[model samples]
Target: MNDNIKSFLSVLALVAVGASATLWWHDMMELRWESRRTMSEAARKDRMLAATRLLQQNGRVVNSVGSLGELIVPKVGGGTMILSGASGTALPGQAEEMLDWVRRGNTLIAEPRSLTSAEKAALAALDPSSEENDDEIEDEEEEVEEPKPAAAPASAQGKDEDKPKDDEDEEEDEEEDHTPPEPPARSYFTAVASDNKDPLTDRFGARVRRDAKACECRTEPAEEDKDKPEAIAAARRERDKTVSRLILPGKSYPLELDGGKMELVGLPNAVAPLWSDDDGGAVRVYREGKGQVVLVTNDYFSNYMLDERDHAQLLLALTELTPGRHVTIVRNLNVLPWYKALWRNYSLFLISLAGGVALMFWAAVRRFGPIIPAPKAERRSLLEHIDASGAWLWKADGGRQVLLEAAREDTLALIRRRAPALFRLPETQLWATLARDCSLPKADVSEALQQDAASHVTRFTRQIRTLQELRNHYER
Candidate 1:
């Protein structure tokens, strides 16, 4: 190909590469935007964060805690506290303690199930008329009771005597008998406007209205109703139809509220109803000592519901009831994992423990000095074998005699090799000649050459030494 053709091909290749890079950059930007949107949605899972922020924005010092134990009670001029996400039941002995805290001039706002037996007792103490009414009913019942004998005589003629004597009495009896039986008690309650004045509800001139019977209030279906599809459909319809609204004098705003199903019953006369419904009170406030307790059955201040209607306004109103600037919100009673709690509370201790463990492990596995090369193998000397053999023979039975005989033979062989003329001589002459040649005593030479075994250790050792000396002198 010519230079022009090559240049044209190179330009086309560069253009293709640039177009591909542009497309890839656009796709990457799209993916980054999509991922950020997903993360933003996931970050909003906390249902109370919005409420906390609202309180902070309104100049209130807000603190969030998981349980009541973490609550910090103010020393003087007590603060307001909102307790949520807990069943109304108090742990053993917690009710009395909590009530005592409330009596110290703190305002407590919580659900119905959060109320303890001690609090109920305090409410009952506030209303003595209920007990009086019960007593009067008992007295009337006792007065209507008659003797058994008198009642039996009346029953004998009751068939005809039971008839009313006058039309007015008959109409009265019919009215009494035909009165519709009181509706069965329900487990749930709704929110409605109360006739009584309240500082919390008076600001907005509005109240949250909810359905009397909605599926959201019932956590589970009844055993008999579970099998009925019609019952299920009706409950779903009611749930769908349930539309809560903040109703003012002329205008109203749509609201969505999540509330507990527990009914607030046995309220004292001293409790000022902020909002109520046909079944029971939805919100109430009462005084104990210098403190006030505000009961809220519905959780309308949640993150999802805070911006709806006037829910946030109601929260601000509740906060205004207290003089203190601090507001503590107990969102849940969940216990944190041990590790997370340790890290949160005793971070220094956990860090120190981790550092100590790491140091210990390092110390255990650390090398102290340079590596030493392995020693080279060496052959044993002849003297070492002889010493080892002597040790083994010394430990054996009759080994001393055998050693003496071996030494005598070895001495004679040395003499014969060095001086064969001395061996040809008679025994006594040979010994004298060997002694003269060796420069050792004649008696030592004869004893060394003798075949007799030494009895004691001292004698045996001496004979072996003499034999070794004669052999050494002749070898030299």
Candidate 2:
């Protein structure tokens, strides 16, 4: 084959291999990321197999009744409306709806990459209760009977005398009432892919960090005498103690979508990604009721918290907040349609793939086409062409002898014609007249009479240039 054909075939073979490999690579990556590369139909059936289990575990299909029933209400277990690859603000007004659920003692298990302001506010508004240590010593357990205060100080035999001075007695009774601190308002039990110090951490434990700021608990206990009978009744003020719990799933949350873009436009200065000992930041909101926005840079209520290590703690938090009514929402890939997935789940891969295709196409079109031959330009030998070197000027007119003799006769005839009566003149006279007329410099007229072969060729070229130059001069 010609070189062009050979190269084109080689490139075509390469491209075919590349295209096949590209499709294969795409399928492989899709399998890895989207969880659909296997026998997809079978997997779908498997996820759906649990439908009956869902109905049995959670109450019933509430959605069949027109309302998504309660996404926020956590049951001993609950059914979920699982969604996948939700991009941008996936569930609009979901935050406000979630807040309403929180108020109704329901739970919202959101799996959005980045939580919205309204969503966060909904969570905060619910104020899910923190999980309390069920094993804590309660009033019944820590009673410490102590034999009814040892029958009251025996020196108190006279009841009339032992009575406290009017106002003092009344104040002592007031101070003696022992009441446990009021339980905190109900809050939310969120699942995030990331965790830092601040509201997201265990607020009762060690000092958690929030974006370089440390949040340590500082409790101010109620002031009450410990010694008196009424003193036991005296309540200690709840401590503002540092409560810290490292949210598992240590991955940074997608503040916006699966790519980690944040949803809320403005993040408060108080809340940061993580906290260190030096951090003094707090999480707060201060907008003029722009739909009650809540901004959380971290993902605390995402699917990443479902790891076995974290499941219990997350479940406990859920129970603490809403007790019997907590719902867990997860993003399930099987439920999504195939065509719509690339943009939502594999956007980066798709973009890079498009670029790769364009590059390969350009490389093929430019490097693998036929070779076209260049035009064969007419060539000329510079010196010979310029001088008409090899041409025979003598033969071009007539052969040597004929041309010479004809020139001699033409010149004689011309002389006779010009001289009028010279036709009858002697040979000697004719010859002399021809010589005289040759004195004129017109090469055309003079060349017609030349007889030498070599001289004719030389004179013909020279004669042509000279006569043409004269004619050009006359014309100009």
Candidate 3:
């Protein structure tokens, strides 16, 4: 082949390879774009963020407070307050205050707090069986006490019959008056959908209900079923089926509620059922004074569940009932951070504390008068040097003997200067001469001159003192 033909073939091959690479890159990009589109965005931290936004979108002023304590009630035209994670039993005093606020023409939407152990025990004590037994006994006694009447004259018989009838009516009235009042109904959340028709549910064109089963389903298996795998599997299957989806008119949504059941007893004012479950009423309403209180059995307005079924619709309908356009949602109760609470409730105290600390730091760093000159550095005194040297020598091993020998040598040298003849004498004679010259005892002079180890501080101190005196005497 010619050179031009070969070059043209090479150029054509390069073009083909470039097109293939470009197509491959475009395919990978498309796959990545599809995957990214399928992935969900990051979840919000606040559980009620969606609900809050929903209220705002409906032209209502929504405010989210941390706790019930921080909730600010309007002075006029009371508005609606939604207690998301709060309950009446959690804070009795605060709950009562909120109720009083409600009585002044406001609406409070809250769930009831879970019953305590003592409360549960008290409820258990009021058993229906016991009440039924008492009623049966009373009925038997009344039957046994029936009395037969004797025949009387026509004129007196009529009056007698009318009098007995009057007496019987009065007795019946007394018995009715003496009867004990019925206990309040205990309501719980259930997986079964609510079939009741109410204003809240009617707004969404469907009934609202929690899909999860009652909390009691989470308990351990019974003793009889402990060893049976089949029994356990059946129980698990039962629990798994508790979750249900809400079938609306056109669409269905999963119910994702997270709350326990609550007892509706001992609540102030008369409670009217709004929604019912298999066990009891799941939602109730009552009036305090001019306003009303709506007690929900579960948290259906949480962030995760707000968009499910008719939860958001239900919330909107509730807020619309209030006189004003403002809505407050209390997310928690008594959950403020310590520092934030201190700053909010005790700002004066915190300000005073900060001022005091700042003053102390200023006093420490700032000069009270004109800047003072730095103290002049000076050499240590001769006595200080001597004391330091002596301390070091005393701490050394066999230091006491060395100290005595040095002192003795100095004394002997001084004596030699005073009397050179003393050096020729023997050690004992020199000690006696030194003792006489220094006016010290002969034994002390001899002990001080000897190279004996000092057993303790007292002996060492005495020997040092004697030698010092002899050296001074010889110098004199």
Candidate 4:
């Protein structure tokens, strides 16, 4: 092969082998855990499909389980909802479509973390602000409210005894009346996104701060009530509820519904506060044409949280928000990740890979290898090797043995070619059949075929040549 082509082929082979190894390793890891869980399987607690079953029983879920663009194209109708958990990270191309779906009145319940830049931009446009215009309008409105004249000082107001306060008392009264306003409470949240002028964030008043590490929350029974028997029985009943025995991630906080009313079931978290004291995370509802956009800081109503606290109640409430609600839960994967595809059908992938490598090898060798002229014959004549070996054997005193073996092989070959059925007979019967077929005397035929019995090379050669002549004459 040519150097360049050979080098390319070598590199290609190395890359294919490396890629195959990587896919094998990934497949092993996937098998090490479990098969990828579908949304319908309820037993997959780790992957959280329990919530899917709950939704299936309660609501009308759409068949929008593919890419995001599929659902957004027709602009999902109002009263229909799209549900997503933390796994529903939108692919890059899906951003615009998702924005349209939400803006067109479809409810999208997703983690703030999954919002793409395009989706965020669409969110920001939901409630566009005019800070400069608002400021100018406020400045214009304030000009009409002129301050009323202050009361006259005590010295000038001798006629009114009730207004006879000293200058020191008047200053003290002004100080008490004009209490300084409390500064705006510090935001315990960081922007879910990096947009400084993000209108959606401003409207919501807060978003989940990504910097806060997730804390594990284990639910335990509340303390017993000793004073009242009724209270103690109630406490015991409350402690036996399913929510008290589960372990859940505390990163999800309750969303306060103001513009929209919130529906929840089950008792509130009685343990230490799960969220920062200052970070009463925000929720905002924006009206877009006939539809509304409800944004929340966290996707707490998900499968992972369904069994913990009121998450199942929260999800049920979402679907039951309006009767006849159609909900579509978007379980997202990457936009056709190649490795995932390969791992999914590894046998086919391996076969294709091997075929490709073989083709590449063939092409490389064909293009790059030196060309040689074709030989005269495909195979040398049969007698050439026999003659060569026979000469050596004769010099080594094994010529008679070679002659005997050759004579026997020649006789078997002739009998196999003609009167083939007789070849399977005993030696004596085969000899008689051969003699009868060749129209020769039995004694002469026997003497000719037994030429191998001669011990000397001269006798053997003479007998072999005689038998050959006799066979040639009989065949003619």
The candidate that wins on TM-score is: 3
Supply the TM-score for candidate 2: 0.21
Residue 229, candidate 4: alpha-carbon lDDT: 76
Clashes of each: 2, 51, 0, 2
Q: TM-score: which is higher, 1 or 3? A: 3
lDDT of 2 by residue, 1-476 (tens): 79999999999999999999999989876656345434355435433323323433554332311122222223324322322222122233443443443444444332223333343444434543211211121222244332354555556646636675895677667867763544432212112213211221121111111211111112223465455555444222112122123322343421111111122221223333232211122211222112111222324333332222333343333333334432343333223355554565687999999999999998889767688789899888797763463355344654544444554555455444556574576655644444444443543444544424335457655544433443333243
Residue pairs in steric clash, candidate 1? 88-113, 88-114
- Residue 87 C-alpha lDDT in model 3: 45
> lDDT per residue, candidate 3, 389-416, as tens digits?
8888889987767777787788767777
- Judge candidate 1 at residue 43 and give its lDDT: 26
Candidate 3 lDDT (Cα, whole model)?
Answer: 0.62
Error (Å) of candidate 4 at residue 121 is 23
Residues 191-274, candidate 1: write the lDDT tens digits. 111212233323222222222343234444688987699878876655544434333222354333333333345433334444
Q: Which of the two, 1 or 2, has more TM-score?
A: 1
CA deviation > 4 Å runs, candidate 2: 1-413, 437-452, 459-476
Candidate 1 error regions (>4 Å):
1-44, 56-81, 85-107, 113-282, 286-292, 308-328, 332-402, 413-419, 424-476
> After aligning candidate 1 to the native by TM-score, how far in Å is the CA of 279 from where it should be?
15
Per-residue lDDT, model 4, residue 10, is 96
**Cα TM-score per model:** 0.37, 0.21, 0.41, 0.31
The full ranking of all candidates by lDDT, starting with the best, is 3, 1, 4, 2
